[model samples]
Target chain A: MAAWGQRLAGVRGVLLDISGVLFDGAEGSGVPIAGSVEAVARLKRSRLKVRFCTNESQKSLGDLVELLQQLGFDISEGEVTAPAPATCLILKERGLRPYLLISDGIRSEFDQIDTSNPNCVVIADAGESFSYQNMNKAFQVLMELENPVLISLGKGRYYKETSGLMLDVGAYVKALEYACGIEAEVVGKPSPEYFKSALQEMGLEAHQAIMIGDDIVGDVGGAQRCGMRALQVRTGKFRKISPEFTASPPLFC
Target chain B: MAAWGQRLAGVRGVLLDISGVLFDGAEGSGVPIAGSVEAVARLKRSRLKVRFCTNESQKSLGDLVELLQQLGFDISEGEVTAPAPATCLILKERGLRPYLLISDGIRSEFDQIDTSNPNCVVIADAGESFSYQNMNKAFQVLMELENPVLISLGKGRYYKETSGLMLDVGAYVKALEYACGIEAEVVGKPSPEYFKSALQEMGLEAHQAIMIGDDIVGDVGGAQRCGMRALQVRTGKFRKISPEFTASPPLFC
Candidate 1:
């Protein structure tokens, strides 16, 4: 199956993670790694279903797609999938939109979340605009509603910088649960069901995609678990794995 | 119980991830989160069990304690437990690790899997480093042995980046099986027996020191199905939901 790269002569489908594989982790701006753009273009020419699977809770796929295109990459918003968007799915299925911890970076994604309705989905996040006041507001709605819940605990750090990674606002939402008492609903990777959901968008077997990323354990490890061929590209921050660190350890601990 | 965090003034046993949260992803440096020192101090001042847990694949509780101290967690590694480390408990008791996958990440985690000993303790996911060649190595050994399989699809990003959220790597490992056209062993989460192996740790009940990760559907959700009050943290990457994307939501599709 993996022979597709050699047999078909280009990646037929790609489950690319943003920030590391493609971008350098700027909030939304980054240079594609050497050979990454050409690699993507080659895949595109083959009509591969190139989907961007990101843990970034900050931006919508549409917005991210535009940014990627502007950055001289062939991309589309429909090709993007993220955790923040999972809230919309749970709400529709359960008939409950409860409350949401969102980011100003991707607040527009909530347009499908029905935030304007007086009794519709609630809004909450750890963005600079977030506050105890906003959390309290969400708390009130949660306490008052028959079934109040959270869209997600935005613990993902989608876009990164060179210095280090930051909390993926979802972490703040998780903290809110400790801040309060009720547990929030979640819908992202690490959650295999969420991966199944993402797979639905790709129209490919979960086993067919190759997850290429910079994070060794996060990107490569997770994909390996879900039954996909994963490549740990040294293109991102994880490459700094102390070259002294055993790449091919003998009798590993 | 969570209200305790409210009534109490200090953080208790800071729940930590094995690799990145405590140790660096590649086993390089133990770059702990900032405030860890103060959190430990505060927890100590508050008089709490300095307990910790991890998803480590290469060490026993004793080895992890040493590593934790070496990494500046200031806690005994004996106080820590990796999900895979407990495999010894089961294999020693049930007398089978299954020769299926033949491996998992971190060889130290599975002390019982002796490839030369005609055992069932299959070693599974070693990472992208785990591939067809490795599977063939596992298979060559397996064809000669006989026992239930031990499949190790390392779920979620085993290696991570400073940017993207955690992803699963099992997809590739499973792909190996697809390519090899054979079934392997099973020895990880959702393996009901593994839970007992963990419970045996610290002689605690399943109610004590439980793992609270994402996957209300997989880990938490399934646990609830198995009679457990799972706290589903919505922090992982796939938390968002859009109503339009529901399986039946024509708008989403």
Candidate 2:
């Protein structure tokens, strides 16, 4: 183990980002990254607690589990964490019926939930369904509702897909925000509460666990803000890390 | 004519806004305003040069002429001007093939133009077609094309529709601009060049022309900036004209 790797030897729990670090979208069929399967196998052999942390709002939790398992990862449904559960909790607690502006692939996650007479707008990357009619409806709802809330799954600007870097939910979310004159409560990575909750689920302290991911802002920056050590991989959406953002610099794994 | 209307009698040319002034969308189907049709007829009988200037990117120039004529206005296609023609002209002059991001209603305007291997993005009110896939493609093209130009039909935030004030192209254009990190060149009303061109085409100087509209910003504000007299009608999207914006105030007609 390298010096940074040796420092992480005592880590009891590992939080890993699925996309870019473990699986590359460019590989088609969500192929696992080279050596990531072995790395995960070794972690499993060591009997360390592992959780796959992801901000993919396009798919449901069950779908994510199936994809990860098919890609040769020893991950279960319980071991995967995403923003949907947290978002759902918030909606229920606040008594808000969300008009989900998410992709069709993930709409099943909220199928059982009440969305009629929606007073809240839950936005994610809706792909081809980000139509003008839907957006206008959301805007009209915001205008008509008193103190309407907007919940964002993630604020990622772009994602690396099979083709190339494509815009995520951030741009479209910002458009709704600008037009409605409201800000969205982000529910995914980079939120300290979200990271802390994941750590708590693993029965580990922030300092005793390490996070591995490709995205600097959503993973490294977020994990570090929660006082967890982070490792940044150069596989997906990793351009060049700036020195100014090096306070909790990820150990390049 | 009212006392305010008398002042515009000496005006050699009239630059009129279509939406909210001559035609009201609140009546659903682009219905003409009360008495406005006869008013335009009187102007036509007087042989006063008149041009219908609009920022409605939802329809084509030919369609606008047909609608205005159906509403009892004696107007020709040549007397109608919109952002689409100006945008098309710019695309042709710059030798750029446009990936048009406009409404299906107006897409027919560009059917005769070449759009293969698009090097420019022409954005308008692309109602319902503003999908994530299309925006990502535009962003990618902007990143890949050498000096890719982004042309906006208008930077309007909302338009008074039959339903209510609905989201316009401004929000989407701003979103694309934010994601791609580029500013779009607006080609519609409020652009001083657009107003000046209308006056030139009418064979009249800006000072000798009078502009009339309901929109405070896109109509009155734009014409006054071009050194033309303006009239603010209380029909469409016009609220109370603030004193702060009264330096080049339009005559309330």
Candidate 3:
């Protein structure tokens, strides 16, 4: 067995990051990464449970799955643990109506949640929707509430897009945090709750799964913190080795 | 003499903060604070050289002076050290054309400087102009530069407006800083260069000047850090005693 295969011996499930791993972040429709289709097929052929965990807030799970399918990846909406759906679930569970500061593409995911009289602020990768009016409106909503609840989709600082690296929700989240003097609760990758929920959906323990991703903090650090074995892939956003993973360099694939 | 008067005995120049000290941050033309008009007249009558040092980037220096004149302040454009004019001067001195991400009101301040092919990004309190498109545009400009230079007007987290506290340029500056992994050079209050410029206009050293304002960090801490005596006014944005000034609390007015 290979060294990586030896490390995955006890892994019962596979948690994969979609964007940057299976496909690069292009303008509209993403181009599937080379061999990612074969890799997904190989994973499905195995007895291990496969789950696609992504912090992609720019598109709906269905749309994302459709895009992946068109790009020749064996991905389904049911197998994905995306931020919007996870956030919607969290909002429904807490009975909190949110004034969403997210991309228009992901708005339908929150259709079930009441947003008329918002009790909290839900922010995501809003892209061009992150206008001052929208941000101030969200700020006003958060300020009006006695106990402001700012729920961020993910806390990635920046992401590699086709144009170049673009500002992510974390930067805006930090802005709101500084302005409001409050911390935001992140709902996507690196949040232990998000990782745990993905694990629970797979009917597997944290130690029973192996997370494969390209993002150093969001994917590898997050999964590792949640007690899951994680592999760092060199494709997509993986520019260089971070100091955090230097000690355990064998995890890189 | 009172303790504050005693502290001001050696002060050769007075750097007054316009918005918070002279008047509250009302919508249009600010209503003068009670006794502020009289206080300005009194300062004018005194031997001490007085200069208005403001981080107000929402309007041009001329407009701000006009508004203050309307609200009954003894002021002139030459006697004011506003961030916009100071930033324009810096841009000219450095021979760097800027792609401005500032409020439309303050655009005239940079009219003298070349903005055709920007070598740097200049940001300020853009108000409703702090949209995703503008921010992204600024980000793209900075990313394209070989050595990115972000010049921020001020580093205030938030400011008190008539409605409530509003996000300032600092928060957006931070967002850009995080996105590009670069630090911004602040051209307004708390920046030693800005303070020194104000003092240079009065022909006085840092120790020979006094700063009086409501903003604890921007006015008091900034001036104090630059070796000037500073007094905190219990007006705009002064909610509680910051620990940084607790040791010398007698400076409050």
Candidate 4:
């Protein structure tokens, strides 16, 4: 396919992925990828509007900004977007009171939201708090509710962690779907609205924006499907996407 | 399709399903289906051999017997067979120490076996104990191990419980399978070996045996595939199996 640097010659906006492209999961957000910090600094100095988009549903937006800043990336809270805030908005608009199944570290993200006698189940990567009791409670809620709703922050099958590529909330989301015979509402990457929202905030048309990330499906393919150009960095767990499945390889950066 | 009683004319042995056929989940094992008790009594009086085979891996064999006896069915611990004991035997034979993911009530079933430094993950219906922490631990164990094995007691999608047809361990088992990219060895009903083992124990061939149960897939289809005749009872959640999918309708009793 086409190359990234040449296509970005006239791009007005950039949507960046955090975990793999900017920093490796092995170093816990401390280690930046080679030239990534400088790349961000250069982009900030340029006229291009930049937005940092991540599928990490475990942490809040503030935490992400802090993490990125710690790795010497020029970012702000307003410029960083994750699945948690969008998921919470959907919960409110749908008039859903959610039984939050998420990590304790990020529960504060839902601090302002109502959680009493929840009719819907909102699941995220809850780290140590994901227990059988919580899943059963969610299952029972679905069975009991006439119209039960299951909202998953991100449907990522797995993610790179310090140990290795670990199982993510997508597996649990699928389990609940199989058990309850209900479909979950994914509120993160690959959910077209997530990309549309970020593009809308940047005031850039889909044609002017490019998504840069290491993940093929979530970042590269998702953005391409959203009518934006995509750049797949060779770093991190990047696999060569088959041409039959995708429009083209994300312009390799 | 031929009727059940007429087709059983010369059947040497009969495999029976427990829940929904003999007992109701709502009644807490105290209530029996209409004439089901006397039916079992009549079967006991006849020359036909009988064995109760179930995919209910949550309870031990003794508990099943006690529940059956409480419902006025003529059943002994030996007459009732479940996946737990057979799965334990397989685990031992394979020399795989398992990280058992099951309910606390049934953990006693695997008490005799060693659970140290487990290389395999054995999952059953953990009920309230099926938490994110336990599933994640199992996932982490599978990731860390050189060759991890996943053994599911039964791959039933759901089972009748007091609340309703609650989620079964199969859902969680499938979740793990999806996340880890591994197939689980299902050790319970619908598995050919499970049916073969029961028939072997009765000293009868598969062709000489008939299976009677409410579930179309687990009981009827499973038995019929193993060369045994199947009887699908109209009681409980019985649905008409499409002619194309099944050999013929089990003689509706």
The top-ranked prediction according to lDDT is 3
Model 3 chain B lowest lDDT segment of ten? B243-252
lDDT of 1 by residue, A53-100 (tens): 776655666777777788777777677777666766666666665555
Model 4 — TM-score against the truth? 0.79
Question: Lowest summed-lDDT stretch of 10 residues in model 2 chain B?
Answer: B242-251
Candidate topping TM-score? 3
Candidate 3, A1-253: lDDT as tens digits: 5985788888999999987788887777877677888888998999999999999998988888889999998877888998887788889899999999988888888888898899999999998888887887887787667789999999887777666667788889888887666789999999999999999999999999999887778998999999999987776665553333433342223
Instruction: Give one digit per residue, the lDDT tens place, for model 3 in B1-253.
Output: 6975776778888889987678876666666767889888888899989999999998988988999898878899989988887787888889999999988888988778899888999999999899887898898788778789999998888777666667788889988887777899998998998899899999999999999887778888899999998887766655553323343342224
Chain B TM, per prediction: 0.60, 0.87, 0.92, 0.89
Task: lDDT for model 3, please.
Answer: 0.84
lDDT by residue (tens digit), candidate 2, B102-184: 77789988876789998889989876677766777887777666576899998776666656777878888878876666788
**Model 2 ranges with Cα > 4 A deviation:** A1-14, A25-29, A43-50, A202-211, A220-232, A239-253, B1-14, B24-29, B42-50, B111-113, B163-165, B202-217, B220-253
Task: Give candidate 2's total backbone clashes.
Answer: 0
Query: What TM-score number comes out for model 2?
Result: 0.81
> Regarding DockQ, does 3 or 4 come out ahead?
3
* TM score of chain A per candidate: 0.72, 0.90, 0.92, 0.88
The complex in candidate 3 yields a DockQ of: 0.62
**Cα lDDT computed for each candidate against the true fold:** 0.48, 0.79, 0.84, 0.79
Shares of reference contacts reproduced by the candidates, in order, are: 0.00, 0.65, 0.68, 0.70
Candidate 3 Cα misplacement greater than 4 A, ranges: A7-9, A25-28, A92-95, A144-146, A240-253, B1-7, B24-29, B92-97, B112-119, B144-146, B240-253
